[model samples]
Target: MANGTTYKTCTCRDEKGKRLGANCPKLRRPSRGGDRWSSTHGKWAYQLELPPHADGTRRNPLRRTGFDTQEEAEAELDHARGLLALDEDAHVKRRITDLILAVLKNTKKLPDTEEVRRKARTHQDLNRQITVAEWLEEFLARKRRIEATTRNGYAAHVRIYLTPYLGDIRLDRLRVSDVAGMFDAIEEFNDVIAIERASGDPERIKKVRYRRPVGASSMHRIRATLRHALNIAIKQDRLRDFNPAAVVELPAVTRPKPVIWTDERVTRWRADYNARTDLARRARARVDVIGCYISTPRPSPVMVWTPAQTSTFLTRAERHRLHLLYRLITLRGLRRGEAVGLRWQDVNFAGNTIGVHWQITQLGWQPVQGKPKTDASDRVIAVDAETMRLLKKHRANQAKERLAAGDAWADSGFAFTDELGRPLHPQIATDQFYWIAFEAGLPPVRLHDLRHGAASLMLAAGVEMKIVQETLGHVSSTFTRDTYTSVYPEVAAAAAESTAALLATPSPSVLSHGRRKPSSARRFRH
Candidate 1:
């Protein structure tokens, strides 16, 4: 019999020939011998029934949740019946069964096998563990093979800039926002330093600080370095997304033109230098007379008397180095690297030319023999008579120094060398050049300014643009013209004058007509 109360009466007659109505509760049970049930319409109805096992144990039917009315329950039953009929063999049902089996099998702990080890190895190969520090080291190692200067720059970025802030951060986990924050911190630090320097009282230096510190150019360089590092990370698969640097805005930097001495100013400074040179020589003679003081100790006497001459000698040595550098840069228009890298073999004394084939770098004053800055920079530069004479004298002095040092001298085969014949560090030469200029009462200018000075002088002297371009070893005349064109006020004035002259002359037709007008008028009167 049905366990729950029957909501409706069945009017159909069963095998007992009794009317199935509301009062006949026994008729509510499912029929014992048939696969159907009787509905209110007196028709055979299909019902959801549990199947009996082979052992005669009946399976429990799915229980239904209570509904407000019998009709609602019947409607839910009907919908469920339709669904079962349509999806009896659905793939989802099979998948659920397979999932259950998998879960049951996986209940036991699996053994570590060779296959698992191989899979782990493959995963490691694809997604290797690499820290920012490790990647930076590898990047620097690779960069070292390219250029020494570039390698040093990369090392500086890693050591001074990157490692301090972001070294501990994992490369794979690095975010764009993290890099941006680091840049902010760097700028803050720079500002604090600037503020401390601005404060006059060095004793209370720590208290003073900049409200908005750091210049735009420094921030820009920091951004650029970060951008490059991130790019490398992306290439190495340490990063999965686009570089954060691409989205971040760097500070705007406006580089001002270098301050150089004008021709008149340079001339005055040179005149002052020559006058000092004479005065220093005369002062040395006076110091010799003061050496006769017997009461003074021998070492102390010479030191006290010759101090001025010693200072002057040191000054002169620095001046000579500066003059050599200036001639190489401004007169010959050689790059700092090329000029410093020059060797005797690279110079053709007979041909009066110098071959640019190598570069000098710091870090042990090593020479990297290679092509010039560009293909055009590799050309031979013809030396003038005065330049040749100066070079010959310089070579003689170098030879004498080499002989004096003998076995102690390092045969670096460089044109510009120290007393021991070892190649001079470019930085040392640059530093000394500036010191010389400062001592000589000249404005401080960078080594590269000499190159600009050369180009400017050439432009001002009415040298052809193409010839100047070739002499400077520029890739094209356009580059030469663009860089030095502004320095050529004389060229511009000459051009203006030529244009004016052309405009001042009468036209040939007008001139001819004017000359013949008197003759024509006289003939007409006749």
Candidate 2:
């Protein structure tokens, strides 16, 4: 319609096998309605001259053959002309032309005109063609101010899950189905991993690189990362109109609730652990219980020590060098990183509060000193009087050690330190906590569970949840309630009684107990 022609052409060959093309005699033969060309000779085709390149170079004509009739070719040519006419600006027309040419060249089809028109209307750069992998890499590269640990997580998600599954997909062409398929594949692979791990063959187990299958929580994170990247592509560059990852459905993740290691639970744990040990010994299998080989599964992934267990651990660790560190975390709910990163300057003995301004997180076993994990994480925790006294004693002990070491001491200002006064690595503190709990003949709980235990103690002591939330530096009370409200038995029982009391009707015995008894003279008169 703009400037195009439809004609018939064929693969008619000459005696020498050369293509006859437009010069074939059959094409010029008279057919119907006085037309010069034969109708049945060849297939119909259309050709149009697109605008020149921005550099003013002459461009090739857009051509398509193999239509069965001239009307089909003409209709397509008209459609192309309509797309070209949507924008009159030379630059936009050139972009539309290039889009059509590229799509035709690669896919043997014209670009979707409506999509191109929408992009043009939105002023999006139609020339940029990036794949999912490329955009993900670029997105990660642009996140300069993100925390190292968060960046590392993004990188791992991209490398392990995203790029491998969705890398080659054109960003604009990605669909919800494509994103959904990736998750489905991951779940299927989880089944494979489970099967391999359960198979006693060591070779099969070794093939399972990640022994733990990708969980619902990790899947959620992967989806989040993908969605974030796509959103940037849409909002920042107008590169895409929709985020397929956003609409994709995944299994819901249930946060593991913390369970208290009460006497009953601890007794059961010890019996199960001992039975496993005995079984392994009788079978002559060298069991690495700590490594989780031939060991008892925990009652819950998150387990908190009861007050008695906490006291027992404290008493056992009193002679240890890091006793104060363990006590601070147990009583104050300090994260392992925060406790490890504590400096002498952060402790205010007069105020009985320790400020949490710094943390040393582990990046694959390497210590990385940084600010607190979150803004809320930077807070001040009030220390109890007894714990404060222990802190002073620990300081005095450290001073004696420093005097004894003299030139050998490193003079590090950290509250918890190694023999040379170097800052304690987070892993080191965890190892010490684990060994101490083991030697104390207590059921195993992770070092971080000490913080959970502290929360339980505060709640059981009738401390307000908002206060506990602030003490633990949680961003919101709701998160604190959801996570730490798996309280001890006593706290749960108290809550139950309180709730029941709201609707309770006094029993006959309670009513009688409140009534005044009749005097002897009044009873005789009656």
Candidate 3:
């Protein structure tokens, strides 16, 4: 058939043989051949002109909807015919415009290209898209410049807790719910070992995995770090919400009561240490004479000290060091760090006071001249006469060693030092104190407990709370009271005694009840 366009007319005759007004309908198609209408079939159809192929030709047919009412159908057909008359390019453009308008109507708000670009730039400048890993890095960087002990603690937490659990999360997307879930997971892990032991099931191994949920104090530290990091993020506009750690309920942890050595225990341990120090001094004196003779070029005198003798001498010296640490703890009540970091300059023999100006940290002793834990901690403590004597003797011994070592000495100017005159590591001193306690057959206690012991002794001896507060460098008298009141047996006994006296005293009514008859007789006699 020839390629042609088609027009259709819907006709139904009236009684006069003319078409009725509603019976006839009109439709039209473009002259450029694409599809044609069939009168016999009463439908619109299309023919595809396929290119010649080696195997076979393909034909595609078009279909249209038919309606029983000719006028209604013809009206619809005319609309379609008008759409087909437009060029393909113009039709596509019109379709795209319709789609965009429909989308705008549905969305109600869509930023323009420039507005989106501006927002992107702002986000870039603020770096508001930082991930959890990036935030952790920044947090660690800030922490590294702090005290070594603090830095080590923070690093340990990041390594053990935060990074493994949350490193991948984007800081901005972190939510309270997510943190809660993590906490639950942590608790599960902490209980896993017990669960696994009870069940003994391989499949439940994950349930039994050992994970330690942080304690209340540790949780406080973690929250501090997280709050600090998130606050930084907020300042940079990277985060809009505060840290979830702040709102999470932390497990309560009661501080353990400080255990202090009794005076009897202190005396015994001190006596043992002093005996060891005297023995060490005698051995060192012998070694000094022998060392001088051995260094001489001419053969003057040969005196051999056996390995056992040398070992005995070394053991005595070791014991002496242990004693010194014990005296530092029990007598002065110095913290392990403060004792280890003490220098000659920090001690004033004339003033009989010790300056707590530095602390021996994990990284070595660091000067903290600005402030101590409180104003009270910064105060000068008057030394006891006995403690002053021991300190002066120790200083003389140190001076002798300094002269002997001469140029080879490290010259750290520390009051307590190794043979090389280098500052003592606080941890080492702490370990030695424990050893000394073991050797002295005394109960084990932390170096800090020494301070507590001092406070407890003062309280037991009727020292005023304010004096104890100032001596310990506590911020307030209340702090001293809280610490020492519980240990003061005398205070408790006195309170109980007063209460008993109040109960034992008879009321005025009881005393007067039996004397009424005698009073009237006595008045009549008078």
Candidate 4:
């Protein structure tokens, strides 16, 4: 085991006023024949020689002062020796010594013996201490396989929320309360955002660029990112023993049910929309139009069109160049990106299947072609005969356009494209859908809602939930039931009648008769 010595020291001066340390006259022992040393003149100190560096460089001795008694100094020296004794390897001993030196330099105290032992036993680096901020940055750098959009989301959580709250904390020292407290602060800031937005003062809103408060769902996502990063730290890098973010509590995310645009709901929504538009018009006339905004929350976040409304929108869009795109999306449940990213070669008229192998995602305003959103999303959807016929017609039109453009045609091979043969931007498709619905006098429904409508239609037609899940590329049937099963009015009515018929009682007229009569009779041959 390592050993050390304890002695007295002081900051006294000689006759020339030169400072004295160990050479102080008050530190002398009475047995040396000098006047008895003053009891209150100096403090006890200790010094221990440490092992050399891994490369054999000489190391300075570990020395500390300011102990009230010799026993106090000696006790700390024993603690340091105990830490060095935990590991037998020379390199480990050197690392423990370094740990002690660092604690003394930064805190004016000895290293925790248990903490040192843990680090040594785990084979973790003792020379480098990582903070939460540093580890998050490193984690993001190693996430190479994730999508750019996903990476951007993780970066936002780290930069805007995580780093600002928990960045300075040591990675190992993070506690569940620390993570929870960060969320609490976020909720408080959310109140500020709401107050600013409700104030209706343009300058106040402009000062806080993110006018919307972070919702409970967004909070869940932030926690997910933090938890995932910490999991990797513990499982992959051995950087932490536990993830504080794992148990941190937040509000549950409640997804709104998809509501069909029934006549009653449509009338209510139209009245609200028209009122908001009128307010905005008047506000624009009174003030600078650039800064004026009239806001109204939608009835529901996810809304789908009824079959009649869907037919009306399709009829209005029938003459448009991308009519087939809208029709396919409505009937086949294709996402906006998937519809725009469809390639001609992936469509098989003979096989009656369309391969969903690629998508064009928007990174800000720029569009980039990439693999489908998930592994399940990359699937082959079977098409009906009528859809195949429309595909042929679309191809013929595309050929004529290609001939007209001649050398100017880009020949991008996308199933839906501009006359010049370039791929369609996803936003343009969304815009066209909006205008077509407006012209058709239909209540508003997002382009993605067409996919929801298709799922509802399938369920109304008595398709199995498992089939719907697979057709929509959902990870699970439970998710499909929870999110995509919007009840149609007719389906709901049929279910109610079927359930009531189970307990139906005989009528008074039938009870008065001698026997029950069959509602339907057929003659039988003898």
> What TM-score against the true fold does each predicted structure earn?
0.42, 0.49, 0.39, 0.48
Ranking by lDDT: 2, 4, 1, 3
Clashes of 3: 3
> How does each model score on lDDT?
0.54, 0.78, 0.52, 0.76
Can you tell me which runs of candidate 2 are displaced by over 4 Å? 1-253, 283-289, 292-295, 504-526
Highest TM-score: which candidate?
2
In terms of lDDT, the poorest run of 10 residues in model 3 is: 293-302
Each candidate: RMSD: 35.7, 25.2, 35.2, 25.2
What is the overall TM-score of model 3 with all chains considered together?
0.39
Worst ten-residue run, lDDT, model 4?
287-296
lDDT of 4: 0.76
Q: Kindly state the number of residue pairs that clash in model 4.
A: 0
Candidate 3 structure quality by residue, lDDT tens digits, 117-195:
3324343422124677788887788665689987877777667666666666887676543443344334424333343
Q: Once model 3 is optimally superposed onto the true structure by TM-score, how far is the C-alpha of residue 373 displaced, in angstroms?
A: 5.2
lDDT of 1: 0.54
Query: How do all the candidates rank in terms of TM-score, highest first?
Result: 2, 4, 1, 3
Evaluate candidate 3 by giving its C-alpha RMSD to the native, one decimal: 35.2
Encode model 2's per-residue lDDT on 218-277: one tens digit a residue. 999999999899898888644545466775645558657888887878788778878867
